[model samples]
Target: MTDGQITLTGIRAHANHGVLASERELGQTFSVDVSLDVDMDTVCDDLTHAVNYALVAQRVLDVLMGEPVNLIETLAGRIADAVLAISPRISSVQVTVHKPHAPVGVALDDVAVTCRKDAE
Candidate 1:
């Protein structure tokens, strides 16, 4: 596989994912960034030869909008796994999950976790 990369950033979804009960009751927005290491040889004029990014985004959104996890780290890993499962052409994936309104009770721009997964 050639060292080709594709990225989808700023994928936003609203969900109940946090350590607080209030968070689960009142969901917040989460932003995901995904980076994929793929086989450049598969890149061709035909859409079938390449990974469809729209589907990837939907998959990420599904994960983000599906379950409630306490940590952003878990959310990141789940997103990575989901993205990698999209196609064998994707060798590895990096996922970053951002939680803007964390319950840390402090002023912060954002809180996030990043995780990477490689094909087995």
Candidate 2:
């Protein structure tokens, strides 16, 4: 970030996704939030240079809907890999996977998993 620019946040996705016998059999949605740190100067100049939230969301949805995974952790990893593949300009990425209906035998709002990847 430079001048008056701060970290740009893309679109946040909320879906009930999970990995459990009951949850998967019944089907669930997973909510995902991605925070990316980018250079505003290049982004502000050209829209193409900026991170496209729609594309990012769609990429994540593709992974979630593509195959049936047994773990949200795996899903998070896949999301991170795909996002990095799509946009190389990204300096760092933070992905959070939220499972609202977990089978904990107790009332819980959601369980989340987060992963971060920085440029190498």
TM-scores, in order shown? 0.94, 0.78
**lDDT of each residue in 1-120, candidate 2, tens digit only:** 442222323334343345556665677666777776655554456768666767877887787676777777888888878887766566777888777766778998888888987756
* Least accurate 10 contiguous residues by lDDT in model 1: 40-49
Task: Give the per-residue lDDT of model 1 (tens digit) for 42-88.
Answer: 54578788888899999999999988998889889888888888999
Off by over 4 Å in 2: 1-19, 42-44
Best by TM-score: 1
The local lDDT score (0 to 100) that residue 82 gets in candidate 1 is 88
Runs with alpha carbons beyond 4 Å of true place in candidate 1: none
Evaluate residue 14 in candidate 1 and report its C-alpha lDDT on the 0 to 100 scale.
85
Best candidate, lDDT = 1
